[model samples]
Target: MTKSGHDILKDRLRRAMGIDLQTVGHNSLRNAVARRMRVLGIKETRQYYELTERRAAELDELIDEVAVNETWFFRDDTPFTVLQRYSRNWLKRGRGSCLRILSVPCASGEEPYSIAIALLEAGVNGPLFKIDAIDISYRALRLARRGIYGRNSFRGRNNFFQRKYFQKTKAGYVIAKHIKHSVNFIRANILAANLPILNSRYDIIFCRNLLIYLDKDNQKVVVSILDKLLVDEGLIFTGHAEPGAFADSVFIPAPYPKAFALTRRSAVVCKPDRVSYNRQILPPSLPVQPLWFTELDTARELADTGQHEEAMECCEQYIRRHGPDKEAYFLMGMILTDMDEPRLAIRMLKKVVYLDPNLVKAIEMLALLYKGLGDDNNYRVFKQRAGRVAARNQPAGKGSE
Candidate 1:
């Protein structure tokens, strides 16, 4: 192996998972590498690197373990909300036809399960719709098949899922057979030169939070392939770090007030409970950070896409140096919101308006926080600011786009 042991490991990772350790933050990358080693019972990075470069039959297992497949049920809340709102119209139009849904990078089935939950809740059932859940990780696929979960994995979902969809099983909770049967699970790599599914055929594709980890070249390749995988009128969803990749596509953005989605002309737009924000839309990332511009964009994106913890570290670093930019406060508020710390989000947003009085989104978000807290007086003020922003952002009498 002409490459250094570390370099060889990076190459194998790039080949299998599209992860470049040189670019991924060293701490996160090292920990992730260590995590894979733990899974494989390797004692150190050197051995792991050696194994990674060997191309032995063990490559598959190692690749699966290293892929940082972090996921959960109802992960983002908005995309599914958008889907839930749109499903009614979709069902109404199709009348009796089956709706085909696909979730690529479906990691352990949470996204597919989320789709199932949304579709079932929308009252569109039976043969009328289907979800094809696919992933590259055989290990992840195996776990998806198991359908068991820990209390912490989805701590509060027991009651809702119990009431809405699942039943007690020999292995914790299995999604009701009806729900399980609604999906066809396949262990497949989306980046394979050819995808098994027909081109341009799915109605909705939930590939959220998956593409950001890939290199830009890979990102473009995947987007082009997904454009083909998506029906002319199908919708494609990506993560907060990834909204930029879709800007030039044939897909038209149907950014609902609260959620994220892009639709073909025939696709329906849904009105969510509240149109919130998502993603940083910056280009590229680096391995380390002193809060570089790309890193700010990444943090802004992390905060934007609702991955607040990852985002907070970036914003907090910026704040430590620059002393409380309103945008930093706004980003901080977003992280707090994702953390389910609405009171904290309120405090953070308050700081945002204190720093920049004209920060409309901060005001609107503050209103939402107050509404959550049942402070109607505060709600009205922030709501008015939101309305003003909305009015100004809106075109006059449709004279312009």
Candidate 2:
């Protein structure tokens, strides 16, 4: 059986960009190819494929279409919180004169901008830190450089950052000049032989959601690249589904819950300096809460660091004090899942869903738990419910993952 021209193009794309067809979907490849073909007025697949082989610029255009550019500011809030804490500690230690951070596949600037905002909220001024944001897509880079964003860029419950950092105009909100100046956006592929930042090492790197889209070999390649680019005690933040890619590497999960941070196994743990909690760093409009509320965060940190027993104890203590809080139950559920206690995790997750029926994460967790437990009927029920909840919660014009 002979492979089609399209199939060969897929192979080419994989080699050129390390994209896993299974992860990104064949439809995306086909759509990108079709789009490029339409632009060039090439009707034949073989003809377009030959052109891509000869012309690197055409191939890059195809890649821009195929790349997923869906992102919002502070997509996962925990990572920024962890970054603030880490930055505070870094400032205290004074290891380096300037803190260096990298955001690979920065995706239309939200992430790197969010990083700037997070650092600013942590009292890290422009002179004290440098952010280098990298992305392959020229289209995304243009938008990032423009530094103006619409509603789609600002999602989730916390919108106070918008009020503090953005000036609303008729043409969407313009990011603060200070925040824009803090980031240096670079257009380059991570898989390139001559990566722009090969000579540079970073104290922190946010390479989230990229590994999940790459093949096993490419995942390893990326991990190696990250290891080389990161300092000994540096932290790397990854997407929720991406940690498994680093299991065979020297990277270990950092003690930060949903932050999805990893550090080198040989990295020395830096003790945090004793600093008073600053309420201003959090959401501006949020009312101050009791100190005991931080127990759940501690539990999550413990769980992330693989202290399952202690995490469970913390969750239990929180539950005893707070009387059946949804957040505590969710944390307990995750901890149980980490401990390989699926049944117990399912029970906790069920309570979380009961307390807040619209909690999609808890619902999805239940679905996964049921599937793991070999209960197909319950799995389907929860999976469908999770889908419904997600659809209801999702904002308009949001791209599907």
Q: Which regions of candidate 1 fall more than 4 Å away from where they truly are?
A: 1-3, 22-24, 27-56, 155-159, 168-171, 198-200, 264-401
Candidate 1 has a TM-score of 0.61
Q: What RMSD, rounded to one decimal, does every model reach?
A: 13.4, 17.0
Question: Model 1 over residues 361-392: C-alpha lDDT tens digits?
Answer: 67778898899889999899889887877677
Worst 10 residues of 1 by lDDT: 282-291
Provide TM-scores for the models. 0.61, 0.70
lDDT of 2 by residue, 72-146 (tens): 999988899878878887887776689999999898999999999999899888899999999989989999999
Backbone N/Cα/C clashes per model: 6, 0
lDDT score for residue 92 of model 2? 78
- Give the Å shift of residue 90 in candidate 2: 0.9
